[model samples]
Target: MTPRYSLSQIVLHWAVAVLVPIQYWTGGSIERTHHAVHMGLSPDPWDVIQHQIHNYAGIAIGALMVARLTLRIFDRGVLRISARGPVDRLAQAMHFAFYAAVIAQAAMGFVASYFWFGIGSFHVLGSRVILGLLALHIAAAAWHTFVWRDETVDRMIIPRRTSS
Candidate 1:
């Protein structure tokens, strides 16, 4: 059995990890920094700038998601989590839901931007749902690390040894 994720997969995983928080920060920052924009009031220059940043970040994430999905399809080295019991099946389902939510959220944001010129309640709802999913993911990691005494998370991390 493969013990580790491919370097590309690891890199992409970390990339998304970094990008997601930035996405949320920028998404919310834009709103808080200038709520008037959403109220149809005169737009502030800074608001436009921040909104642009959020838009670009979302686009970049979307592009990265596509690349990640492509790599997932082609990379045969991906480590499979063997389904040992109910927990394993639940983990698999959670993984699928996470990926689907991410793709759908990105699509929703893009569509909202294209048609409404800004994000709305639907995009915010998606963000909240994704946040909940992320919490579950982290909890699962903790469970593997503490209760299961597994090296699952370690497999996704970069090796400490330089001589790999």
Candidate 2:
């Protein structure tokens, strides 16, 4: 049976998806509360804890992305969803955009970590760009899943069936 994604691909996809959100949540909380805490505006400990989570999660996500891309380039298990028509083609385009955006965002996060946040705070230009792209990506996925009633999202998340 042909798999929608090789075991490795599926694993990486889900892993990265799960990690990205954690990183985003932590990073965003830190960004919002950092200045306030420094200025004694808020005494919530959420900022410090979230910042650590963000930093660790970012590193893990970045590493996972590298592995995912490497597998994509080197292995044949990753398949772009097969398009049935113009609308499917459009969906495929959007999916491709999501993949590209994620990679770019991860790269930016890595660079930003080194350049801006000093590798500890997890502040990076990439995180901001990632937030915007993630918003767009999620919106597109929702539109495809609910509004368009397309299988694009399912094909990625669910295993595909094969004919004998």
Candidate 3:
């Protein structure tokens, strides 16, 4: 039987998942708007809209990450599919990396926008790290689904109707 994530877990996971891409897709627009406003020029309306989405979505991701972590702490007996091996350790490390990268990236975005601090430079690196982490995560999921023939992905995708 495949273990399934809690419904709250699944919902929060997909919510943040959906918002992360919005941040990436609209990232450029925020930069353009920032520069345009700084240079005493009128920013494009579309850029402004995209920038707003980028900002709000970033906040949403940060909030969702926090909520996910909190829910994880309280989500005892939740179904986890791991082999208790080196792969499991690596997976844990990857998950930690994801949490740190995303939280820091969002924090730096807030600081860089609201303050004169020099942390803006690092946010770009954080974004690239996020991209790398995301790629690795997707690859692992694909491996689990196809190469490994594991039903691990099913846990998040499908909820078991019968209670464990």
Candidate 4:
């Protein structure tokens, strides 16, 4: 069988990885630095710009995730877990939770934007959820790589061929 993630999947995976950090950082920064109640000091215009970029990036990430999920469902290149071992089961559960969190965070971000900010939210509660899930996802990946010494994370990053 195939040796690695499809080019599209790999690209999407990395793209989301890069974008999510920016989304989280800017989101929190904007909320902290630009609160109307702040009596300390106003945020610079760049902070405002970063907030805008963060908002847009949220939408882009959400769209890309939806596309990734669609492709995973339709494409034959996506691999399945090889066994039902404990680690494998944990990986499967984490993967499912990651997808669900992504969807939920994206939806919430959109709604927060519309309700809280207006015209740009795009249902972004999912974005906040994504931030939390991302931390868990990364920790799980590290565990799989460093502690479990499994090929699961490696497979997603660089697939191994299966004997046919």
Instruction: Highest TM-score: give the candidate number.
Output: 3
Cα error of candidate 2 at position 75, Å: 1.6
lDDT of 2 by residue, 35-131 (tens): 7867978746877778677767777776777787787667755775568999768766765665665666665556555566454333355566567
Better structure of 3 and 4 per TM-score: 3
- The lowest-lDDT stretch of 10 consecutive residues in candidate 3 is 74-83
What's the TM for model 2?
0.63
lDDT of 1 by residue, 29-83 (tens): 5565456755878767766777788878877777777777777667666666688
RMSD versus native structure for model 4: 4.5
TM-score of each: 0.82, 0.63, 0.90, 0.74
Q: Is 1 or 2 the stronger prediction by lDDT?
A: 1
Given candidate 2, what's the lDDT at residue 40? Answer: 75
Candidate 4 ranges with C-alpha deviation above 4 Å: 1-3, 32-34, 37-43, 115-129, 159-164
By lDDT, the best candidate is 3
**Residue-wise lDDT of candidate 3 within 1-164, one digit each (tens)?**
66677887788889989999998899899678979988999999999999888878888898888777777667675665365899988988898788888988888887876784478679878999999999999999999989999887888888656555
Give the TM-score (vs. native) of candidate 4: 0.74
Residue ranges of candidate 3 with Cα displaced over 4 Å = 80-83, 160-164
Model 1 clash pairs? none
